[model samples]
Every structure is written in structure tokens, then in C-alpha cells.
Target: MVRGDPIDRRLRTLVLLGLLLGLAGCAGGAHRLPYDSWRLGLFAPNYMEVWIETADAVDVQDRVFRRAMNGVAAINTPKNLKGDPRGWPTRSGAGAGKQVLGADLPRLVYVRWQSLAEPQTYEAYIVIPEATRRAMVKPETGYCPARGIWREDYRDMLTVGLAPGGIARVWLMGGCLSAIDVVRVQGTVVKKGPYGGKSGGQHRPLSATSKAYIEKYGIPYGSW
Candidate 1:
């Protein structure tokens, strides 16, 4: 059997060890990162009812549309928004109002909604800011490694707020219902004038919580 010099053998062993260490570092880095799929919640905070025609997640890398939501419509009715005593929009426990959106960060979200009262349809292809995506996967504030990680408490849910005049806002619902505004995407009207039935009813007054929200963060286009 042929054998290399002792120094040559040691150098080859070191190179192989270096490669293994590099691969291990990469694997560890990826393991610490969060997954691509996350839960999503939709809300209609406007007094007038809003019908969601489509809410899709677009993988811009592949240019494919993923139907993240199906058979669900958001309307700001008293009963629909009743679960949360704080008056913030909550899931109605019916239909797929809350679903999983699978896509990488900074993906495009295309939403289409119909203002039932105005009978106008609005649509927009919104993009989530890259910074916001990074924040979403960050470790919890005051985290302690000794306590271990609670995978479920990773704050992996995002809420989309819909209002009249095609004003759309995205919020990251952190632990303990702490919502942080991520981005605002303005939509353009696609169709106008009574596309279907008449107005559901007269516009109701904004809920107290909604009033506070608007006072802090005004709705787009001066829409209620």
C-alpha cells in the first residue's frame, strides 16, 4: 500500500475537518431560522361590509400564486367582531378567514375586495417589507435559553386589515395580542357601481376600538 508523507496526511485531514466544520456551521444557521409558512388573519374594520374575492400569496421568485384563503369573506358586523372584548377584529370562527400562508419572506400578497355599500371592487398586489419579515422571526424579547423554546409562541401570525376605499394594512400579531403595523398597501378600484346587491344597510358608527385605531393611524384615502 502506498502512503503519503506524514505532513501531507495531516494536511489532508485538516482540510476535510475544515469542510465538515463549514457544513456544520451552515446547518446550524439554517436550523436557527424560522419556517416559511405562517398563520394569517383577515379583518374588515370598516363600518360597511366588505367582501373578499381573493387573497393569494405570490412567490415572486417563482411567479406563482398560492390561494392562501378560500370561501371566506370579512364583514365588520357586531356579532362578527364580538369575541375580542377589546373590539379589535378577531377571527369569526367560520370559514377559512384564518389560514396558513406558505411563502418566503417579502412575498407578494394580492388581495381583492368588494365594498358592498359602494358596490366597488378594489385590488392590489402588496409586498411585505423585508425588514418586517426579519423582525417576525426574531427571538422573543427577554428570551432565556435555559427556559427552552416554545415553538408555538413564535409570533408566526400576521393580520391583514381591510377598510373602505381600498385601504389595506398588515400587522404582525406578536405574543400577547401585541400588534405591530408592518406595511400599508393601497388598492385601486377595478369596478365601480352596484356590481351585485344593494347596500347591506346604512353605515354603522365605528367601534370605540376602531375609533382609537383610526386616531392613532389614520385610514388611507380618508376612508373610515
Candidate 2:
């Protein structure tokens, strides 16, 4: 009986030590930061003060285009964006573009073009750190803006990049939008695939249904 008592005490001490060690291991790994896969710092970002001026020839069509572009940029900045599992980013917003900046913690930066000028254009500068530049590759070719001639089509096709990283991506999409647009924002770390993939430039022609909505509601979407 006496010998058994000593052995039991030693066993209890060992069990307690093991539990403490396991907890310490978990604590150490919990706060570790995620590592980005792309090579950084290859693209030389020029130091240009943000400036944009539209020619006098620009028209109302150009002004409307500028307003939509601003709306898209606003949507991408904060909680309106998400990363696609297939490597592309998607907007989490309800109607138009998603806001994704704060949620994803991506290192990419987006800035709206400095002015509300005609021939409306916005610029995004992708930055790569000095380390990742070697392996970094440019985005795929399919990601271009669609030039929609119709008003409804123009609004739907307008989009901006959200939570961008070493690679910059902008996408345009159009469809039927309800009055109570519900925007859902989510985030995932993208480690591989094309920088910007899919029908980025794919423009959606204004459907008969959307035209009816516009006729009834007269620009259901609010002003920029």
C-alpha cells in the first residue's frame, strides 16, 4: 500500500505538467500571423500626386459614369468584399460592389481618382514589398472594364477593387437589384491563382426587366 501511494503521487504530477505544456503550445500558435505567398517589391510605384482633369468635351454620360465609379470605390473600402475560394475576390455588398477593406486585412491599398472630372477614371496602385517581387506575376488578361452604352448597364458594370494585396483587381457586374439591397461581406486569405480572373470586362446589357424598374422607380439607387 505504501509503495502504491508514492507511484500515484508521481503520476498525478506528470499529468498536470503534460496539460500545462499542451495549453502553452496552443497559446503560442493561436496568435501567429498569416504569411502571404506572393513575392513582394518588384513593381516600381511612381510618385505622382493624385490629379485628374477631364477635357471640356466630356458630357453628362461621362458625369454619370464618374458617379457610378465613385459608388463602386466606396463599396470596396470597408466591409463589402470577400475572397473567392477559386482565387478571385467577390463583392459582399447587397446591390452593386462589396466593401472589403477592413475585414480581410489585406495589404493592398485603393484610392479613388482625385477628381469628379469627365471621362471619369479611377486609379489603383498595387504595391509589392521588397521580398516578394521576384515571384510576383501580373494579373490575367480577362479583367478589363466593359463600356456600357445604356444607363442601367453602366451602373451594373461599374466596380472597384477591395482589400487588394500585392495584386490589384477590379471587376464589373450587372443585374436586377431590389430596393432592399442586402450586402454581405466575408474574408478569406488567398494564397494562389490568377490575380484577377473571370469576366471582369464582361458587360451586362440592360435587360427589359431592369429598364422597366428604371422607368417605374427612376434610378432606384441613391446619389453618389
Candidate 3:
């Protein structure tokens, strides 16, 4: 009921194809991997965390960051969702200055962008079934900003289907970190499909810079 018939059919076909092609081992192996392995790259349970950067380098003064943050905050607020944490970063010095005051921050700072192109400005997360380690996608999650950290709370979920190796690949669109993680995790944004679908929705072909970045980062082909 949660997923559409078309996607389920595609997954079944893919499973059958993999079995027929003698890729059952690969498929089985990926399936058998502990949920934590899939979540955190073979790390200990609860050790998985992903840091995504924008596709284009957003300047501290970019309007896109401000606008996107505003959108996110609107989605997060109790008036909407009644989230606890408050105030996302802005192009103005206020957010930047606030970030500077944080402890143990990353050396590379993230500035806002001029544009958060359609699909580029999405959120994502993961979920694990009780008997299985495979994390499935959920319908929606709450977006809460607490003490400057962004958190996705997986209250409900819906997942996208791709091959096992898909989650390993992260896309870096340009010099900036514009990439999408192809896995299901708590608080992750739903970027694809009708309900969460973008207005423009389609991605323009990658530019040379984007290609180079993807290559340099060793993005898994499944990521695209």
C-alpha cells in the first residue's frame, strides 16, 4: 500500500534479472550485509552519518541559501510541524556569525547559494525493518534545526528502489557538494516522485565541472 505497483514491479524484475545473470551472489551479499553496514559504510551500528554539500558553491551572501532555509524552516515550524529548534542560517552575517561561535565545526564553511535548483534542494533519510537491516524510505519526516545541527525525524517513510551498490555513490554536482544520497535514513528528505516532486523536476545534464567532481569523488554510478 505504501509503494506503487510500478516500482514494486521494477524491483521484482531487477531481482529476477540479477538472479538470471549469475549476479545472485552480489545481490545476496548486499542483501545479507547488516543494516548498519548499509547505513554507515560497514561501520558499527549507529555509526552512520552523511554530510552533503550544495551542488554549487554557495556564497555566504547567496539568496538561495536564505530562501531554501526559509522554506525548510517553514516546513519545520510547529505552526506547521511544531519543531523545537529554531532559526536556520542566512546570507546575512547573523547566521554566519552564529555558526562561527559553534564548537568543533568543520573547517570548510557552507554558504548559501543563488539558486537551489529544483531537485537539488531536497532532504532525505533512512529506515530499517525490525527483522531486516535494509532501510526503506518513508513518506515524510520532520525537519528540525537544533543548536545549528539539522535533523530529519523519521516519523513516516517511503523508499526509492535501486540496486544494492546504489547508496555508496554520492553525487557532487559542481565544485560545491550538490549530491543526493540514495538510501533511506531517519530525517532524510524525499526528493523524487509525485508528492515530494519538484515543479521542474528534471535534472539538466551534468556539466564538465560536475563530471570532474563526480569522477574525483568516485561516485557510484547508481547515485545518479
Candidate 4:
């Protein structure tokens, strides 16, 4: 085959074009981000029960990005408080959780809830730090697995705590049942409502075990 032959030149051009196309495909894939799944958990102290109304994602400018929950009728504290961190109640139903893509990562989470201790609906905008979001995509390693199974579910756990007088707390679950405090957003009364309704419920005394747990560890905020 001659160096400048028409047939040789044609083959070289086709090979170069194929290489360029392959490179372009790789670049596109690198920029594309994978979807991350998340579930909501809650912590309420002093036998306080909280009813979650809405938990939505907002952008930096406070624009609604995604509505995670809307009047889902879910409780923060479970009926049976066993004093075990793992036994805490997380919001159930299809809307209690969300799957977010990288491009749609929320800068803040707007949460609204009603507590039996207050006669009004309380709302707050919880910030999701850029570091936490980045960690979500690339979770830390070196943590031992549970029973020989590496649990990836911790990366998807987001817990919210409610206290009397419109106090709120937020945390992102870390590996090995660790809770990393994201921030505490003080709740503000958004609207007035009847003291007793869907948000109202019969108060029950904390179990002996749960009382002891709280006595020792204080209110289970981000820890569980």
C-alpha cells in the first residue's frame, strides 16, 4: 500500500472519525450523574407526636425543586417506642421518599409539620450542604459491613426531628448507624389551625425502656 494512496487515505480518515466519536461518547457519560434514592426519618422527644405535612426540595433562590411529601399522613414518632435507635419510625408511602438526580440536587429542604404541643402549623427551610451532597454521591469507605453485607442504605437516610415550641433538627445518616448533623432550622408558625384534628392524637407515656434511653442519651435527634 502506497503512503499517499487514495485507498490508504480513506481508511485513515474513517479510523480518525471513529476515534473522535468514541471520545465524545466517553465525555458525555462522564458528565452524566447517577440518581440517588432517599428516605425520611423523624425524632420527637417528650412523648411529642409530629405529623409531617410536606417535605420538599428547594433551590438556592428558594424556588421549589421537588415536593417530597404533601399531607402524607405520616407520623414522626412511632406508636411503640422501644428505646432502640433502629426502631424509630420513618415516613412511609410512595411519597415519603424521593429519587434525585445529580443535576437536580437540592440546596435546601423545606419541611412543614404540626406538633401536638402547638396549635399552629410550623415550617422551616433546612439546608442541604454542598459537602453532604457531594458525600452522598461518593460515600466514605473503611466501615465494616453488617453481617458480611455492605449496607448502602445508610447513604439514603435523612432524618428530621421536631421538638416543643417549634424546634426542628435535621441529619444525614452516615455509615455504621452514625448520624451526621446537617443543620438545625428553627421552625416558624406558618398558619393557625385547630388544636385537635388529623394532627392531634392521644398522648401516651414513653415506655420504661424508652424513658431510660432518653434519660441517658437525651432526646434522640440525629443519632436515631
Q: Against the correct fold, how does model 1 do in TM-score?
A: 0.56
Work out the TM-score per prediction: 0.56, 0.19, 0.19, 0.53
| Candidate 3 lDDT over residue span 1-224, tens digit each | 01112223313443343235442232212222211111111110010111222211111111111111111101111223222221211111111111111111011112111111122323321211221212222212333333443444321111122111213121111111122333332223334522234435543333343334333433322222
Total colliding residue pairs, candidate 3:
23
Clashes of each: 0, 15, 23, 0
**In candidate 1, what are the lDDT values of residues 85-135, reduced to their tens digit?**
223354322222544444443345667766553436777666665556666
Sort order, TM-score high to low: 1, 4, 3, 2
> How many clashes does the backbone of model 4 have?
0
Give stretches of model 2 more than 4 Å off. Answer: 1-122, 125-155, 164-167, 177-224
Superposing every Cα of model 1 onto the true structure, what RMSD results?
A: 16.4
Model 3 worst lDDT run, 10 consecutive residues:
38-47
lDDT of each: 0.51, 0.22, 0.21, 0.48
lDDT of candidate 4 over 28-138, digit per residue (tens): 233223434345555565344456665655432223434455433333333354434432345311223444333233355666676643334676756566666555555
Clashes of 2: 15
Tens-digit per-residue lDDT, 21-68, candidate 2: 332222222222132211111110111111211100101111101111
Better of 1 and 2 by TM-score: 1
